[model samples]
Target: MAYVIAKKKNTDEKPFDYLPKFHTLRDGTEVILDYYDNQDEEETYRILKDIVDDGQSYPQETMETIQEFKDYYLSHDAFVVRQAQTAEVLGAFYIKPNFPGRCSHLSNAGFIVKPSARRKGIARFMAQNYLYMARDLGYKASMFNLVFVNNEGSLKLWRDLGFVEIGRIPNAGNLKGVGFTDAVQFYYDFATLPQKQ
Candidate 1:
């Protein structure tokens, strides 16, 4: 089980450097982190669009072609996790400054894993790695703005990782016939408890 998380660069070989790998409980699958090149705006957006389209996920960011241009064209970073051997992409995530001006000390992240890779700890790894990256990049806090209340797995994972619920939007999301559901907001102060670098 080998893997890595390399910074995105314009190379022909492995796009990501080796980070770490984990195994699935039943089938014994392996996964790793791979940063998305902020330079390849077009290709990266296509990959993100495909994931969102396939998962039918929330907030409809499908129209966001250039994530690098989100925060006054000074956005943070994004990455995708994939298998080393088979080259199977498991998920992707983005870390952006929480706001402009003084609020830029804080950051927010969004993650989506392929359906075939769920329940395998890929998201947990991605989330943990993102936090580590944020800290290394000098961010003071991290937040998740639109975590749907029904997303039990993510809520539990984040909670266990020390994130706390700060607020909830009343009926913020529609889950098919389930009517509207509240979107929970979670926050983590990274400055107080520094992650191991």
Candidate 2:
């Protein structure tokens, strides 16, 4: 018998990527969605820190330092959404391989919005951008491993975007004040998305 193994893939994440998007939110706030860069570090770190401190969404209790935040948030392809007028970072996200070797085609993502900027539709914008970016980065599918059951906003968003609940884990998180929380695993195949891009 002959065995042929698959080699790691280096996607055209740069040349064919970084397609910046501009949009107006419900309240007429102009936001620009673009590739993340060095200048975005501080604000992204702050946003992530706030999310971590909230203890309602993210898994971490605290990020500790910017360096630690970068290692987790910026290790793979990341993007940021900024307010066009002031250039303030509104939110950001990252897409990375969920597993190594043969499972590299499956990607995972994390997202956060400035606490003051929630309900402005930033999450929807990032979610839309993530699908295209993940596909462009050569991922076959995207999965969220620990979406807390109490995270109604995220649960609604993911479901609205057509993500399927593959499985549910009981008592998946110990939320700050919510005692034990269940979580649902979400999965979305890139091929299921419309190839408009």
User: Candidate 1's residue-wise lDDT over 27-142, tens digit each?
Assistant: 56665566654443554455556654543336563445564334322244667776767756667777767666677778877787767677877878788777777776677889
* Angstrom error at residue 69, model 2: 0.4
How many clashes in each candidate? 5, 0
Best lDDT among the predictions, by candidate number: 2
Q: On a 0 to 100 scale, what is the lDDT of residue 31 in model 2? A: 92
Candidate 1 residue pairs in clash (backbone atoms < 3 Å) = 4-18, 4-19, 5-18, 5-19, 6-17
Q: For every candidate structure, what is the RMSD over all alpha carbons to the true structure, in angstroms?
A: 8.0, 4.7
Q: lDDT for each of the candidates?
A: 0.66, 0.87
Q: Residue by residue across 1-197, what tens digits does model 2's lDDT show? A: 64333333545456444567889998899999988888999999998997898899888878989999977887777889999999899999988888777888999999999988999899998998788888877899998999998889999999999999999989988999897899999999999988865
TM-score of decoy 1: 0.72
| TM-score for candidate 2, residues paired by index | 0.91
Stretches of candidate 1 off by over 4 Å are 1-27, 37-57, 61-75, 194-197
